[model samples]
Target: MIQSDTIHGIYGTEAAAPPKSQPMHLSMLPCDLKRHWGRCGITANFLATSTEIPSPAAASIISTVINEILENSVKYSAIDTKPIDVELSIRNNTVECEVKNWARLEDATIIDSYFKIIHDKDIEDLYFLQLEKTATDSNNASQIGLLGVMHDYPVTLGCRIQTTADPITPFQISVKAKIYLNEVTP
Candidate 1:
């Protein structure tokens, strides 16, 4: 059986400070992963309208980050039995986005590596360059997608992954990212 604790953590707490500006909420069937992309676009629009900073660059980065994380959930998560959950919130000038899904224990290691690469500032650029050089390599496409997001949003890209496993249990992967609008574009 799959544990539900991880899901609870992702959606559990209410924000300490509600967004001074309007909040946007979106949810859809994970059957069409394209809806995830659409949600990202909506997030970008929210960021652009709410923040004082010019949003062209920030919007692009935000959209890419959301899509990359959502795409991972859609691709690696168990189908039918488990649907991906994504939530986005902007509060106190920071945007927090999380995506969670069910998986096997072994998959947690892969999720760890993804976070390590995404959070490493020095290596992220090099990693992206390598990915670009090998863009035609199908096997590495997913890694490239992640690298692209890290490269574009290096300053405000903070990511975390949590997992738990036990006998006869399904593992869970939850990815969270926070982007500080003031720090990124100011």
Candidate 2:
């Protein structure tokens, strides 16, 4: 089924964007911490231009968003050797960005629950609540980038967190951002 907007599912369900028969840009970034950050911009630039988004502003917006996603993928990746998979595709009036990475089961549970709490209606409320939670956390970390992406941008978010029965096996997190083409163009 072609999902219209929000996508959230655990195992045994298709919790991803409608498959892109042929993605415009597909990249596999090996978990090279030193190099991954620099490569995100280069790849995002290619995605914006090669995808031919038309409006310069929209292109810039899309590129920035993709770069952010890439950065998050690098941060959350569980294993050093596993590669992060990113796909860019155009579907009807939306441009979709999907990033898949391996995550520790603990991290997967937290992120999955976070997604579940955010529905179409109360995202703003949850956004601020999350802000406080992250701020007070022991790591002194922040995930506001994602909350801002979900709140500030004209995009629909989807996620599929694939789990395994074996406790030793790492889980997979697939995050998708679907930006409406029409909302983006001025």
Top-lDDT candidate index: 2
What lDDT is reached at residue 30 by model 1? 54
Candidate 2 lDDT by residue in tens digits, 35-130: 656787888788877875768888888887888777777777777677788888876767888888777766677666666766444779878887
In candidate 2, clashing pairs total 0
What would the per-residue lDDT of candidate 1 be over residues 138-177, giving only the tens digit for each residue? 6644466655555566434433344445443256677666
Clashes of 1: 0
TM-score of each: 0.63, 0.77
Choose the strongest candidate by TM-score: 2
Off by over 4 Å in 1: 1-29, 34-57, 117-121, 154-169, 183-186
| Models, CA RMSD each | 5.6, 5.4
Q: Residue 142's C-alpha lDDT in candidate 1? A: 46
